[model samples]
Structure formats: C-alpha cells, structure tokens
Target: MLRVIGKRLLLLVPTMIGLSILLFAWVRALPGGPAVALLGEKATPEAIERVNELYGFDRPWYEQYFIWAGRLLQGDFGTSIQTSRPVVDEFMRRFPATLELSFLALIIAVGIGVPLGYFAARRYGKVSDHASVILSLVGITIPVFFLAFILKFIFAVKLGWLPSDGRQSPRIDATHPTGFYVWDGIITGEFDAAWNAIVHLILPAVALATIPLAIIVRITRASVLEVQNADFVRTGKGKGVAPRTLRTRFIMRNALLPVVTTIGLQAGLLISGAVLTETVFAFPGIGSFLATAIFQRDFPVLQGFIIFIALAYALINLIVDVSYTLIDPRVRVQ
Candidate 1:
C-alpha cells in the first residue's frame, strides 16, 4: 500500500506541471490581456505597459511561469489583478461554500443513487427498472445552469419557500465569517440565517449533482447486474441464504468497486459543473471566482484555478485507488 501510494504521489507531480503549463499558455493566448481588461478601452498604451510590468506580464513566458510557480510552492497564490487581494485569501473565503455545496450534493447523490441502482438491478426488465433508466437519462440530459434557473423559479419565486439568491438573509450580520454561511450562522446562533443559507444552497447543489447521480446510478446498476450472476452469488442462493442477505453481502459488496470509482471521478466533474451552476445561482464560490478571472483575462488567477482543479482531480483518483483495497481484499496494491 505504501509503495502504491508513493508511486501515485510521484505521478501527480508531472501531471500537475503539465496541467499548469497548458493552462498558463492557454490563458496567455486568449484575446485580451489583464491590463486591457482591467484598464478598459480608453486607457493609454503607456498605462497598459505599466500595468503589465507591475504584474510581471512583461517578462518572458518561462520567467513568468517560474515566478508564479515559485510563489505557489511557497504557498503564495499571488494577488488578483482585478481585486488587488491575495488570491489565496480570496480562495479561502469562497472555497468553503463551494465545498459545502459539493459535499451536500455528493451525499445526496450517493444516498439516493446507490439504492435506486440496486433496486433497478434487482428488478431488471420490469417497469421499475425502465422508470429508473428514464429518470437517469433525463437527469444526465438536462443542462445544469438551466436546471438551476428553473429550480430557482419554481422553488424560490413561484412557491416562495426559499430565498432567491445570496448565501444568507441580508438582515443577518455577517460578523462571524467562516466562508461557509451555514456553519457560521449556526455558530453565531443565527437560526434564520442558517436556514436561509441551506435553502439557497439546495437548487445549486441539486443542479450540480444531477448528472453525477445519474451516472452513478447507471454505473451501479450495470455493475450490480454483472455481479449478481457471479458464481458466489449463485452459490449463496443455492445454500438457501436469504435473498436480501445474499444481495447485500455477496452482490452489493462486489459491485461497489466500480461504483466507488465512478463516485470519485464524479467529484472532479462536479467542480467543473459548479462553474456554470454557481454563475446561474449567483453563488459566491471558486467557480464564480474563476469566471471573473477568465473575463478579466487574469492569467495568474486562471492558471492557479486550473492547476487547482487538476490537482483536485488527481487527488480524488488517488483516494479512489486507496479505497479499492478496502472494498475488495483481492485488490492488492503494488
């Protein structure tokens, strides 16, 4: 296990470096530079040059990358060109909200997806299975931003059950800031604020989760069906073991490996999907931060965000690989 972990960690370095280079070049290649975007059309060329020099954009691409990468290694994400605030501080402020929403969505996805898949597999060829398939297809087919808007319209505007936008009610004093409005509200004993935060989060979380949940359900159903026909399941059944016991212990246990892999991969996908969902909902999160950075052509912010996302993807895959050993003893590491 240690050897496997070491190997995976080693592989992550080059992957991250390649991702950073690609993102750095791609952001630089975009139509406008941060200076023009920030200074606007009327700004003088000299002004733009000064801004470029200040931000180190005047340097050679390799030199700029080395400087940025060095700062990143020292845990300094640099300052945002648009806001003049430390990028890491901005990230720290917004990331928890995104993390909270993503975590909730994953919980909802796994809680609902796994059982539905199991039932669908057990009832294969029946109406229930067909219904589950249709639902999963629809979930995957809809666009997340569109879904978020529709949900907000129905649940917030039409029904008047939830707040339309923002993390918490405006009336609440945001004195206690943990970046996560829900937790901060609770800690501050602001129940109404906490409740509002949770309500506002639901639409975005659901929108982000829809595709992943559908993918998980489909994958789980397929995996479960494959395992159900295995010799061990048949043997357990032949021994007169209870149907539920055999399905849970023998079938579900073996089927979980693929499902776990899917779930882990879905975590990475959700971060990308959150960009659109967060924008639609006007939620303050890493997605919103990245969108603003893109619009401003802030190469540093863009590079940092993309590299962060790539690292997130690699880390989740590593976690999934480690989890494999726990799920199936036969999965020997190294």
Candidate 2:
C-alpha cells in the first residue's frame, strides 16, 4: 500500500505539468485578454498595448507559462487582476463553503442511493424495484438547474419552509471561524445557527445530489445483482451461512468495488456541478467566484482555480484507489 501510494504521488508531478500546459493555453486562447476586461473595450490601442506589456501578456506564451509555473512552484498563486488579492487567499475563503456543500450533498446521495439500490436488487421485478428504477431514471434525466429552481420555488418561496439563498439567514448572528457555518455554529454553542445552517443546506444539497444519487443507485443495483450470482456467493449460501452474513460479507463487499469507483468520480464532478447549483441559489462558493472570474477574464484566478481543481481530482482518485484494499482483502495481494 505504501509503495502504491508513493507511485501515485510520483505520477501526479507529470499529470500536473501536463494539466498546467493545457490550462495555460486554453485561458490564453479565450477571445478577450485581461486588458480588454480591465479597461473598457473602447480603450485606445496604445493603452491596451501598455496594459498587455504591464501584465507581460506581450511575452511569448511559453515564456509566460514558465514564469507563471515557476511562481506556482514557489507557492505564489499570483494576484487576481480584478480583486488585486492573492488567488490562494480568495480561494481559501470560498473553498470551505463549496467543500461543505459538496460533502453534505455526497452524504445525502450515498445515504439514500446505496440502500435504495440494495433493496431494489434484493426485490428485483417487484413493484418496489420498478419504482426505484423509475425514480433513478427521473433523477438522471432532470436538469440540475431546473430542479434547483423548482425546489427553491416550492420549498423557499411557496411554503417558506427553507431559506432560498446563502449559507444562513441574515437574522442569525453566527460567527464563521472556520468558514463552515454549521461547524462554527456548533462550536460556539449556537445551536439555532447550526440548525438554521442545516436548513439552508437542504434544498441545494438535494439539487446537487440528484444525478449522483441516480448513478449510484443504478451502479449499486447492477453490481449487487452481478455479485449475487458469483460462485463464491452461491457457495456461501450452499454452506448454510446465515443469510445476513452472506449478503453483507459475500455479496455487498464484493459489489462495493465498482460502487466505490463510481462514488469517487461523482464526488469530483460535484465540485464542477456546484457552479450551476450555487448560481441558482445565490450561494457564495468557489464555483460562483470562478464564474465571475471567467466573465472578467481574471487570468490568474482562472489558472490558479483550474490547478487547484486538477490537484483535488487527482488526490480524490488516489484516495479511492487506496481504499480498494481495505474494502476487499483480495485487492491487498494485487
């Protein structure tokens, strides 16, 4: 396991280098430069040229990339053109919000998806199974943004059961020491703030969880069905093993490998998907921050954000790969 982890870490170096190259090229390839975004498009040609030279946009792409990459290696994620603040500072401020949202959404997805899937498989061809299948299909087919709107309208506007936007209600005077409202609220002994934070999270988390929940259900159902027919599972049953033990040990454990992989992939995607969800709910997170950066052509913010996301994805994959050994002893020898 140590050797495998070491190898994966080693591989991340080249992966990041390659990703950096593509990110650099793609951001530069965008139609407008920082100068145009900074100064109005009506700015004089000389003024724009001076702005380009000031930011070294006049330099060759390779030279610019190398300079930026060197700064990155030195732990300086460059200053944002729009905010004139360090990219890392801005990212850290918003990242916890996004992370908190994504974490909750995943919990909801896995909590509901896995059991629904397992039971659907156990009662295959029954009405319950068909209902699960139909629900999963609806989850996959519905667009997240539309669902978000519907949820907001019904729960927030019509029923007034939940807050529609932001992490907590403005009336709640809670201090966010760590940028995570729920945790901050609890540690401060402000239970109302904590509960309110949770209330605000429900609609958006459910909206974000929809697709991942659907995918996990389908994958879990298929994996369980396939594993149930395996020779080992049948052998365990034939040997008069307790039904519960047989299902848990011989069936679900083996089925979890694929399900785990799917989960890891979906978790990474959740970060990306949060952009639309965040926008709909007016949630303050890294996704909405980046969306604004794109329109403003904040190159440093854009570049730094992509690098952060790439590293996050790589680490998630690494963690998932390592977990396989723990889930199934058979994977340990391999």
**Stretches of model 1 off by over 4 angstroms after superposition:** 174-177, 187-189
What TM-score fits each model? 0.95, 0.97
List, residue by residue over 67-164, the lDDT tens digit for candidate 2: 99999999999999999999999999989888889999999999999999999999999999999999999999999999999999999999998899
How high is the CA lDDT of each candidate model? 0.86, 0.93
On residues 120-160, what C-alpha lDDT tens digit does candidate 1 reach at each position?
A: 99999999999999999999999888888898899888998
Clash pairs of candidate 1? none
The candidate that achieves the highest lDDT relative to the unseen native structure? 2
Q: How close is candidate 1 to the true structure, as a TM-score?
A: 0.95
Please give the RMSD to the true structure for each candidate, in Å.
1.6, 1.1
The 10-residue segment of model 1 with minimum total lDDT is 168-177
Name every residue pair that clashes in candidate 2.
none
lDDT of 2: 0.93
